[model samples]
Target: MIMPRKGGKEAHDEMHKANPNLKVIFMSGYTADAIHESFGLIARVPFLSKPFGPSSLARKVREVLDTQ
Candidate 1:
């Protein structure tokens, strides 16, 4: 589950609680202050800041997916 700040984090949180096995990869184009305002602590999730290159994006996705 990939949840950016644009969509409500509550939805993700609720879904996450229901299925704790889910691995959420969050992305954000907003600044730190904006991200804090938009979202609370994303429980058991990896956060990926935007403007990332292909290697970082691919590596992260692979790292998460490979573990599963």
Candidate 2:
């Protein structure tokens, strides 16, 4: 998982370029909608917002893991 700022997306892209099968889950303080609206990247990766509860985090991780 990564934060989409300060070259985060660049690094993620580089990793994906090296390994197309890489599964990424982006975490941000911003809401998913905000991230999508601002960066137009919701279609590219799974995301989890900050201040989430353990259950939410676990569920998201499980969802990503299952998909990948």
Candidate 3:
């Protein structure tokens, strides 16, 4: 059981304000649709569902890194 001091979007927003070029890949146990509805985030944001293996993570990182 893990506890977070701040929400992922809040932390990301703060970091993004400091660095506009920062790329993010959100990882959560919840589904993408659920996250979008709850967080009010756009569909363009990258996301990774939980239980992903190294390969999937690597691919997602590469994809985000390659995005404009």
Candidate 4:
């Protein structure tokens, strides 16, 4: 997961360029729509909003892992 303060999309793009098969689960305080709109991440990438509990985090992680 990447938590870039700025240039988040660029960072993600670079990572993907380096390793296209890398699985990423973006976590942010912003809503998923906001992140998607801002980053142009229209792809079905997994996302987790901030302020989540341990179980929530765990569940999201598992979901991402399972899909990959």
Candidate 5:
């Protein structure tokens, strides 16, 4: 579940309740402080910032999934 840091807090919170076990990769170019303030701490996973290289992102995805 990849959700934007945009939209209101309600949208972000709703997603977790729907599927708490879902693996989410909250991608945001904004700083970590901004994301935490808006969405609260995600125990599932951290976020991916913008401008990340393709291979790095792919590797991350694979690593996350591989753990499952």
Candidate 6:
């Protein structure tokens, strides 16, 4: 579980500080737009909305990996 005081982005930031090449696919049960606005994430950032199936998960992973 993530710390209540620190969200995923904060945790990712800390991790990224250690390894700048880290790639992430943020996930949330909230709607993608809501998550993006609330989290201050860019539209093109890799994200996976909840309740996704295997194929969708695979596709998202591939998309993130394929991105520069």
Q: How much lDDT does each candidate structure score?
A: 0.68, 0.78, 0.88, 0.83, 0.66, 0.83
* Candidate 2 residue-wise lDDT, 1-68, digit = tens: 34456455777779989999988878888888877777667565888888889999889888988984
Top-lDDT structure, candidate number: 3
Candidate 1 local lDDT, 1-68, one digit each (tens) = 23465364777668779998777667777654566556765344556778788999888888888776
**Candidate no. 2 TM-score:** 0.75
- The worst-scoring run of ten residues by lDDT in candidate 2 lies at 1-10
Stretches > 4 Å off in candidate 6: 1-5
> After superposition, which runs of candidate 5 have C-alpha atoms over 4 Å from their true positions?
1-9
Q: List the residue pairs that clash in candidate 3.
A: none
lDDT of 4: 0.83
TM-score of each: 0.59, 0.75, 0.91, 0.81, 0.60, 0.84
Cα lDDT of model 3 by residue, 28-66, tens digit:
999989988788879999999898999999999999998
Give the per-residue lDDT of model 6 (tens digit) for 1-68: 14679887788779989998888888888887987888787898788888899999999999988877
Between candidates 3 and 5, the lDDT winner: 3
For model 3 the TM-score comes to 0.91
Q: Can you write out model 4's per-residue Cα lDDT over 1-68, one digit (the tens) per residue? A: 34546477778789999998887878899999988988889759888898889999889888887885
User: After superposing candidate 1, which stretches have Cα over 4 Å from the reference?
Assistant: 1-6, 31-38, 42-44, 66-68
For candidate 5, the per-residue lDDT at 59 reads 81
True-structure RMSD for candidate 4: 2.6
| Deviation from native of the Cα of residue 7 in model 6, angstroms | 0.9
Model 5 pairs in collision: none
